[model samples]
Target chain A: MLITGIKSRPVYDRLAPMASGLRHLAIAQGSGGQPMLRLLADMTPAQRGVATVVYSSESFTGNSYEAELRAVDGIDLRLCASNVEALQVLDDLLSTAKMGTRLYLAGSEGFIGTAMQRATEYGLDRDEILREHAGSFVRRVWCAHCNAYTENVTQRIFRCPGCGLDLVVRDHYSSRLAAFQGVKADGEVPGELPEIEELDT
Target chain B: MTPTAEPTAFTTDETYTPEGAYTFRNSREGVRRLPFPFPDDEYMYSMNLEPHVPAGDGAMRAAFDIDEHYISECHHRAQMLEAMPGVHYLALPHMMEAQWDLLELIFESYARDYPEHFTLTKTGNEWHWQNRLLGIDDTFTFGDPTTLPLEPMEYATRQAQGEFVVLEERDNDLVIGAGMTTQRADYSLRFNLGMRFFEFHGPVPKLHEMGILDRALKFLLRMKPGHPVRRVNWSLTVNPRLETSVETLPEWAPDRATVDAENAGERVYLRIELQPLHRLPRSNAIVFPVRTYLVSLAELVEHAPDWAKRIHRALASLDPELVDYKGFHRYHAAAVAWLAQHDDGAPLATGYPWAEGGIQPGD
Candidate 1:
């Protein structure tokens, strides 16, 4: 894999059990279930007793380990059909989460970014969370012209559904917006655009 | 050098319009004070910072400079913000304390330096600010957002002339949490609001590997509350338009194509930002104020021939990646060629390029 040299991109870590944490919340989506299971297996019985898992079946690549995750014993599991529902479950759990809680996130870039945003809302620092990337690198882009977010974007140039302008996705990522930036493709000269190609996904 | 049409008349008392025949060039005082960044005959990225204490002539005399274009730039910023609402100003939930700190800093600076134009009075948190230039006189309780028409940071930035961003230090890293960025070079405040120092500078080439940002961040982290630091960063703009933000690329990006060697003198502009970073007393956040100064290529060649020679060499020696990153790659060749005519390739002095007869430090 070629590293794109995009420093703004969040670095993903491998999921593992932190022995120091008294409570654990593991949130996973799609292909992320494998890492979540691995993390749960690494945890001791006491850690599992205090763990809450939220798994979303949504997968861009159609990979699922929900059954395997459910088969695991001695832990609480909450399953959802979509990533949004899984996020809601995480939110509800985090609202009452204590200081000793350690969060583990596994999924695509967009999933981790949105989950990190929610974690930031409740004043969770980087030390309190560990994120592992699992799925493809389809980007969630924010259109500069119309301020609309288009998710799962794989192409460099696409028409913004919000304002209907042909936008070229810049390699720069915004952790605040939890999305990559997209500006007008032919902004310099109308109807004249640079060559289009697939993103480095 | 070829002769261009003379700029319009400008005076401090009169209303200066940005569209009014380039009034910036006509102000001899302002032209002499232009903070030309190229003291050497070459350009490169570095932590070229200095104490923000008063130094040099006009522009460097104060931490915040309110020049002849102050009113015009403020009016233009208001119009840009209104046209592009919600994109120029943003503050996260935790940045409110820093906002008030920034408001107090600007208010105190302006009132003390330009007493004729601004006055700030405080009596146990009941504050009164008066801006004679904009005819603004209002009273509000300190640290209260509901008392003011706009948020504290936005209110202060609206009256000031340039871009302002507040960076909060956390986990040994500074995060850009709040800003009023109507006049950014080519970035969006909304998108870059929560970025760390190195992350925001990620688009620029070669700065990270060279450890420039690392050193710069270290220097900023050590800045004390009372002491401030300043640096000069330059880029080229198609016109004297202040709103060169990425969101409005469709409007101003096309103007690059309209420039050729013949018209490059009039069309191309040297956009210099006087970035002054100050640590807020209360919030301990660093308030980065980017005070912009624009001089046209023609104005440089016409008024200061020494500047033309130095700029020619600086632009010619610029890294290809930097030229492309500055968004002037389209007209880079034409500009270099046009600036070549004014350069005799002579060596210049080794200090800040102050114009002849301009006041130097300790003069």
Candidate 2:
């Protein structure tokens, strides 16, 4: 099955269990920082074949023990001088992995997309692809002065609190589930689920 | 150049082939989903870790299934996002103090490569970035006072007109007061970085600025050593100025006219007063600011939906390039699932299924 969009959640959820099954498990974290390593240490056994990758940046250096693990596991954990360098290293390692092998891509959407393209070019089938988008959307309301969001009628009537523009609700669904949830025609709640406090708000 | 061949240092004695990739399958039923779980509720939340090989064992298992599964999932997510245009995923702890240096490097690369597309700013107390092409003016409120006085004092003394008159005198006690003000608003995206802590005075007596004096004297003759000194009674009073922003903030510049007009030319303000007590002692008082930030995207997303969508797409697109893609997925999923499982009936916004209602767990 060519898993993409929302279809990939099931696959992503099993990462920890799958890693446990490997004889020599390698975990790579791009150059965010030591938090990833601490999280990994808290989640996995030290005896597991665990390797980490860390890419250094101006604000951070991937010189910790966790970073070493990433390089040893055939992952590039150093800060790339340019986007091109980052794409190149990611492409090389992903392509070298054997076919039918499950590859886990974690990080920003841009990083995942680049790696996916490289993997496909290297002979991985579309069915082998799975993804989860991890970011919030930037919502722009209709400003009476700006006259934005006039295109979508369903979002009409509301005025921009910022600029008093005729506001229209814009959908910023990064994940397939979010997109699916955005499409409900009626006010009927999904599955009669109880309301949760808006923690993000 | 082909990679140089180097002897692989095996951390463990065990070795295994890369086959049986198909042996691991996604069991949908086995997976659990819940809404975002709060850190405060210890009963419903738990974290566990285990080693693949037993400690002190010479030859241990080469790999653990869970680790492989995490890697595979990360790869899958990357591919999925690649198919979707303008979406990105981000691994977090990006700017946590311990990880700030490394995350900053990654951010700089993105900024350099996509200068026109990305802009970084401080919102609330945190730092965040967004694609400038979206043309969304992220709004944030910052009317809190930056500095406040720890305490204020008042003193009174009485003098006699003639040398023979021994008039009794009393002293007024000291009083302390605190004030705070919300300053202004900026692009909300900056809040993602963190918050700055301001000085918050605790109890008034703790400030160490209260004291009294003892003196003794004879009316007709020169005073001798060890003469008894008359004790004067002392008392205190506190009056705090609540509306002090008018004097605190300087005259508005041409650029601030719009914001000042919007807020009725008034800044948000908060103040507290401490009444004086007789028994307190005199000591040096210290006032320091304690800073913190709130890095939430919800408010900005609500006000500027289109801009939020554009930034979301840009972030989604960048996911694969980031490390720990799998870890981010797990954390996000778990947060959503925990929210789903525990949501009580409350009003919430769209997109956040877990927060569709106002039922949030205690912190």
Candidate 3:
């Protein structure tokens, strides 16, 4: 009931070559590599030559496409141990990226949304960036009581480790926080709580 | 003042809101959010007014919405302010709360429309404001201006898509108390900051007689804090320029008469607007969000071929008084002819400069 097909959830894009790009950037993490492979395959050799790849191996599923990503390359491919590092390199690339540059993103909801925050900061329009959700739908939750962020949230009702409150994940998603809201689940009644179930996310 | 008493005449209130370097000190961060103000179509202007009533579940989209050009537009405004320090924002000391309210109102609307990109939260006595585009995550007391990293009005304008003006009622008439406007037809906002509503709209004919200005202000005064009212106004410009506030028109106005067949597609533009007025409950100020959209005549011909003839006829239909007021000037004949004959698309035709890559008038 907490997540009845949350309407605020972002509609992910299918990775295809945004042919208008003068330069291309393909950034991915974990199983996000699969979409990157397809994107690279769809790109022409000239496009491939102009493109740059930044891969973050931080995988919740332990899925790595590192070897395959390296194998299919004449482009500059940089490996990052964490998504944060990958995002930092992306910021640097976009800092100087020209008007015609295009961005392709594939990763978890957290990863894709956070990456979009960067693209938006750099003045990249939606037409210039393509984001495809690759992995699980586990959300990032922000506890309203404590302003603490919990990553990889799955259940609709969970105990907030940050403030020890019974948190009910709300359907409303904050792209700025890159997370869903988690408020005291039983705030209305002393002992009453919603059924603890997996989120539809 | 409860906004009930009517004033048929007025005097400029000497009491002005305080603005200083300390209040306006801005950190060089965050992207500007500019909404696409036009839809591709034949253009017309009317008193086309409507209520801010929600269509369903009390979730109605505002007349203005943030679009892709936010960051770039912010850059333009910031650079302009740097180049011309005293041209844009003007405010009275009493309008400070309205400034903060304006920030809260716009950020809350953005958080609703883009739940993913923004978060405006209130916990106990503190409010947390976060903007993903600006990379800002800040917490402050709801009414306390000092808690904010930047001044309330400046922060609000920087994040807003449209250049804004806050009109307050005093002595039975409305006055533009505060604003952060970079674009105006040929008017200097610095000199016009404290002007009455009637004086501000003096050039637009028949509005006062139609009771539009009076009715509109009453509507704004009674409008809910969260709900925003929208209106459209339009004109044809020589090029796709956003900074055409009347003071700067001389730079682009001369180019109009010279616009000929070969370059008309690149030069002539349809400057459309999406104007939204939001009421701040606490301050009783009306924040006007003016979003200007510019689409080239060439691009219009390419998409809406009938638009060429429609506008031509519309131009011809206008009365002499209106023609004299609009002042098409030297480029008038060439523009009309180009619109008439250039309907047949050329093989290598293109879009307006801004339309091609940036946020366009996709409406």
Per residue, candidate 2 scores C-alpha lDDT tens digits across B17-109 of 113222222121111111112212111101111222211111111111111133233233233235332222111121122122222322333
Per-candidate Cα RMSD to the true structure, in Å, reads 4.6, 35.3, 25.0
Question: Candidate 3, which CAPRI tier?
Answer: incorrect
List ranges where model 1 is wrong by over 4 Å: A1-4, B1-26, B354-363
Q: Which candidate's DockQ is highest?
A: 1
Error of 1 at A181 (Å): 0.8
Cα-based TM-score, every candidate: 0.93, 0.20, 0.51
lDDT of 1 by residue, A1-201 (tens): 011368898988998898889999999999899999999999999999999999999999999999999999999999999999999999999999998999999998999999999998988889889999998999999998889999899998899999999998888899878999999888878998767889997
- Model 2 achieves a DockQ score of 0.01
The predicted structure with the larger TM-score, 1 or 2, is 1
Clashing pairs in 1: none
Report the error of model 2 at residue A192, Å: 37
Q: What is the lDDT of residue B93 in candidate 1?
A: 84
Greater TM-score among 2 and 3 belongs to 3
lDDT of 3 by residue, B1-363 (tens): 011122112111211012211111111110111122222322233555555433221112333454444555666677667766666777767788888878877877778766666798999759887877767788888778888776788877777767788888766567888888876654556545656666566555556566788876666656666676666566666654566553344344455555876677667666656677777888877888777655566665555444444455555455444444454544556676777674443222222212344223221
